[model samples]
Target: MNKTCPNCGALLIKDAWETVETNDNGSYVFKSYLALKCLQRCGYYERADQNDQE
Candidate 1:
């Protein structure tokens, strides 16, 4: 899990301690990994989204 985005200094979440699965959909987790991003409508999140596709 990441506390701040590597590309940008943005908080991934409000919680101090958070764990995220790189690929989480519905009730399934495609892969177990850590990803950090800013949800403030930036290219970073988009890039991450695209990377997830691969």
Candidate 2:
């Protein structure tokens, strides 16, 4: 799967460290292991973590 910026449809590359967060369900969630850059405009990126993969 390719990570892209929410603002712009730019491909996000793995530029930084990976971030993980634990939900209330006591399951660990992997947010993003990559950095997304917007070429046209600056925006936010939102994605859902796969519980099975985590």
Candidate 3:
């Protein structure tokens, strides 16, 4: 089942999060993750499981 915002009753949306990091040696690392967000933009969000399980 999909998740809904408790305050607004709107369907939650799935989105991706990504970031890049660099070290003093000029090496860089990339990171990404999934998250669920409230469609109403209520500042509600949670990270998705690494296995993509609900």
Candidate with the greatest lDDT versus the true structure: 3
lDDT score for residue 5 of model 1:
57
Give the runs in model 1 whose Cα sits over 4 Å from its true position.
14-39, 43-54
Instruction: Give the range where candidate 2 is weakest over 10 consecutive residues by summed lDDT.
Output: 45-54
Reference-based lDDT, residue 31, model 3: 90
All candidates' lDDT scores?
A: 0.43, 0.53, 0.80
What lDDT tens digits, residue by residue, belong to model 2 across residues 1-54?
766675566865434345788899999987554444444446453333453123
Model 1 C-alpha lDDT per residue in residues 3-34, reported as the tens digit of each score:
45557677553212233455445463344333
Selected candidate, larger lDDT, 1 vs 2: 2
After best superposition, candidate 2 residue 12: deviation in angstroms? 0.5
TM-score of 1: 0.26
Model 3, 1-54: lDDT tens per residue? 788977788887888767799989999999988987789898777787764444
2 against 3, candidate with superior TM-score: 3
RMSD of 1: 10.3
TM-score of each: 0.26, 0.32, 0.56
User: Which pairs of residues clash in candidate 1, taking residues 3 or more apart in a chain or in different chains?
Assistant: none
Q: If ranked by lDDT, best first, what sequence of candidates would result?
A: 3, 2, 1
